[model samples]
Target: MDTGRRAGEPLVRHTVSPHLTRLLIDAGTAAGLDRGQVMRLPGFDTLSVDPVRIPTATIMRTWEAVGGALMEVGGVARVMELWRPGTLGVWDYLFTAAGTLTDALRASGLHFAVIADPVDAIAVTRDGAGVTVSWDGPYRDHPSYPLIAEFVPSMFQTVASSGAGRPLTPVQVRLPHRAPLSHAALCELYGTRNVEFEAGAPSITFTEADAATPLPQSDPALAAILNDHARITVETARPVVSWLDRFHLALETAVGDGPPELARVAHRLAMGPRTLQRRLNEAGTSWREELERLRQRRVDQYLRETSLSVESIAARVGYSDPRALRRAIHRWYGHSPRTVRQNPD
Candidate 1:
C-alpha cells in the first residue's frame, strides 16, 4: 500500500469476475515472478474462476500484492498492460457484441454492475465532448488509487478502442489525484498529449467522432443475448417484493432480535408455518434454506468486516455454539470460517 493515501475501508458488498484474480496471477508470472510466489499470497490458494464476492478492503489489498510484484519486476505500466478483452468475463462481451462505440459505452455504463461494481462505482457518462469516467469511490482515498488510476483508464481505453475498431485516443486525461508517473509516461500509455492532474474526478475524454464509429465485430443478436443475461443477473441480485421476498425480509428483520428455528416469522406474516413452508416450497426453497441463507449472509459480513471473534459473531447470529457456527459457515461457503474470513467475501 502507498503511504500517500488513506487506508481502504469499504462498507458494502460488491463482486467482480474471478477471471481478474486468475489474470492477476498470470500478470505476476508475466512480470517474471514464479507462479508459486503469487500463489503464496493470502486467498490465492482458493481463488476460483467465477465472479468473486469482495469487501472494500480486499480489492486494495489485492492490488497491493499485484502492484508490488509488477513494480519490482516490470514497473507499474506492465500492470495496466495486462488487461485484455475477457478480463471482466461476461461483461467483456459487450464490446464484441456492440454495434458501435457509442453503443458499447452505453452498454458498459448500464450493465457494468454485473461485473465490476464496488460499494460505489465510477460512473460512466457520455456527452457532446466525450464519455467521462470518475474513479472516485470508497477507494478514492486509498493509497493504491495511483496504481488503480493507471490500470483502469488503460483497460477502459483498450476496450473502447478495440470495440470501435479504431484508435479511440483520449483528448485529455483528468485525474482526481496526483500523478505518480511522469506526464510523458502517461501520454505514451494513453496516446493522449493532454494529461491533466489533480483535476476533479479522474476522467478521460474521447473525440465525438471516435465515439460514433462502428465496431467491426458488431452482432446485434449476440448483444441482445448478453444484455438480457446482464439484466437478469442484476435483477435477481435485488430483493424483489414477491411473496418469497416478504418471507426472506421477515427472516432478515427478525434475525437481529434472535432467530428461533424459523420463529414467529411465518406467524407474523399472517400464515401458519406449514402454509409458509408450502409457499416457499412452491418457490423452490424451504424455511430452513432461507434461514440458512440469511444467517450465511450476516455471518459473512461479520467475519469479513469486523474484528469480532468467531464466538461473538456466532452468538450475534443466533448460533448456540461456535461449533455450530463453524459447521453452518462451512455449509454455506464450502470452506471453514477462518478460510472464508481470510478471503473476505
Candidate 2:
C-alpha cells in the first residue's frame, strides 16, 4: 500500500524554517545588506513566518536575493543554518523509523504536509534487482529553484551518514529537467551527479541490500511530541487563509483608484475601523504591519522574478516615487533595488 498517499487532515501552513531564515539573513549581510534587516521584518517574531499569504514565486525570489548574499558571506555553513530544529527533528524521526534510505524518503513525504511549504513528494517501487525512490514536485520557474533543489540531495546524504554512522559519498542524482546553468548549482549544492530530464519519473535506484536495514523502534515520548507539533503547526493555517482573503479584497478595492487606508479596508469588510482593528489585534497582528508585509513580499517578488523597471514596480506596489520604494527595499533587505535586480540570490 502507498502509505504516503493516504488521506488525512492537512498539515500546518508553510513556515519559513528558522535555519533557512538564518541562512537568508547571513546571505543578505554578505551581499552588503545589513543582517539586521531580516529581523526588522514585522512578522519575524520567531524563525517561522506565520500566515505566509504571498505566492510561492515571490517567496522563491526573496530566497534567491538573500541566498546570493548568504553564499558570499559564509557559504555552506551559513546555508546549513537554515534548517530548523523542528524540521530536522521530523527528518530524524523518519530516518529512524524507515528500513532504508528509500523508505525514509517515503516517510518524509507522508509527514511533509506538516511543513508550511512542502517541496517534494516521495514514492518507492520495486524493479528487477533494486528499489527506486522517486521524488517529484512542481518546480516553479525561478533562479532559486535550482538552489532549493540542492536540499533534497543534502537531506538524503545527511540521513545516509546518520544511519551509516559515518560520512557517505555522494550518490548519482536523477533530475526531471534538462541541464541548465543551474544544473551546476545542483553539483555545488548536493555534490551529486545530475541526470538530464527524464520522462518516466525522477528517482534514485539502489540495491535492495540497502533496504533490509531495520529502523530503531520509535520513542513513545518523542512520537507524542512530534504529533503535537504537527497539530499545533497545522492550526496556524487557518489564520493564513483568513489573511489571504482579507488582503485580496483590500487589493481588489484599492485597484479601483481607491485609497489604501485601514478605514477603506474596514469598510469593504463591512466593519467599522475600530472593529477591524480590534479583530486584527485579536488575531495577534495589525493593519499597518500586514500592509507593509504584503507590500514588501510583492515588491521583492517583482524585483527578482520580473524585468519590470523600478518605476513600474513601484507604481504597481502603490509607490509613486521609485526612490522611496528603493529606500523601503533597503530597509527591508538592507540593499538597493538595483543590487537585488543585478544579482538575485
Candidate 3:
C-alpha cells in the first residue's frame, strides 16, 4: 500500500522546509549578494538555521527578492552553479543512497514533502520507455510561482544526475507557465535547447535506462536511516489545519493585489465579517492586528530587499500617503524606513 497517497484534507496553508530557503540565500550570497544584508531583510531575518518549517509565502517572497538580485549580478542561472550534492541534507543523501535511479525517484515521490511542500505535489509515474516526475499543485497562485516552476525541474535534474553518477539529460522538460524573457540559460542548464512552456504541468521525463542507473553512493543502510528520518519528519511536521491558518492564507492571497479587505476575506472564507473577527479573536488575534503585521512585513521586505523607492513601496503596500507609511514604520519599529533598511536586523 502506498500510504503516501492516502487521501486527506488539504492544508489550509503551505510551508517549505528551511533548507530550500537557505539554498536561495546561499546562491544569492555566492552571486555576490551580502549574506547579512539578505538575511536581515524582512522575510528571511526570522528564519532559523535549524530545519524548522518556513511559511511558503515567506520563501516565495525571499526567492522573488533574491532571484531578482541574482539576475542583476550574474543571472539566476548562478543558483545551478552554486548547487552541489548534500545541499538538501538528508533528502539529497536519500537519493544518492538509493539502490538505483528508479528507487531514488520512488523515494523522491515518498519523501519530497518532508523537505518541500504541497505534500503530494510530486508524482512519479512510468511512461512506457520513460519515467515522468510531475510537480503541479496550488502553487500557481504564488507570486514566486514562475521561479519556483523553473527551479524545481532544474534542481531535480541536478539531483538525479548526481545520483546517477552521470550527466543524464531529461527526455523532455515541460512547464505550465509562460516562457521567461530569456530561457536560453534554462535550456543550457536542462541540457536541452527547447523547453516546452505552457504545458499541462511541470514535469521531467527520463529514459528508462537512465532511471535504472545504479548510483555509486548506494548504501542500503544509509538509505534506510534517511528514509526513517524522512518518514518521521513528514508525520510530525504535518501542518495543522485551522481557521487561523485559513485566515492567514486568505491574507496572503490578497497581498500586492491590495490591502486585504475584511469583508472580502471573510467572504472567501465562507463566513461573515463578524464571524471572521470572532474567530480571529478566539485565535488571540484580530483583523487589524493581522493586516498591520502583514503590512509591516511587506514594508520591511521592500525597504531592505530591493531598490524600490519609498513612495512606490508605500503604494504597493496600500499606503496612499508616504508620510502615513513613514509614521506606521516608525510606530512598528521605532525607526525610520531608511534606518530599518540600512540596519534590518
Please tell me which predicted candidate would have the highest TM-score against the true structure. 3
Per-residue lDDT for 47-158 in model 1, tens only?
Answer: 5534333322234446655665675664546754666776766667787789876677667656665555444455666777775655555444233455666666776688
Worst 10 residues of 3 by lDDT: 1-10
Best-to-worst ranking by TM-score: 3, 1, 2
Task: Supply the TM-score for candidate 2.
Answer: 0.55
State the local distance difference test value for candidate 3: 0.73
lDDT for position 27 in model 3: 85
In terms of lDDT, the best-performing candidate is 3
Task: Report residue 35 deviation for candidate 2 (angstroms).
Answer: 2.8
Candidate 3 shows a clash count of 0
Model 2, residue 193: displacement in angstroms?
A: 3.1
Report model 1's TM-score to 2 decimal places.
0.59
TM-score of each: 0.59, 0.55, 0.70
Comparing 1 and 3 by lDDT, which wins? 3
lDDT for position 30 in model 2: 55
What value does the lDDT take at residue 77 in candidate 1? 63
lDDT tens digits, residues 229-303, model 2? Answer: 544444454323344445444543353232267777777778898998888888777887766765786677667
Give the Å error, residue 307, model 3. Answer: 20
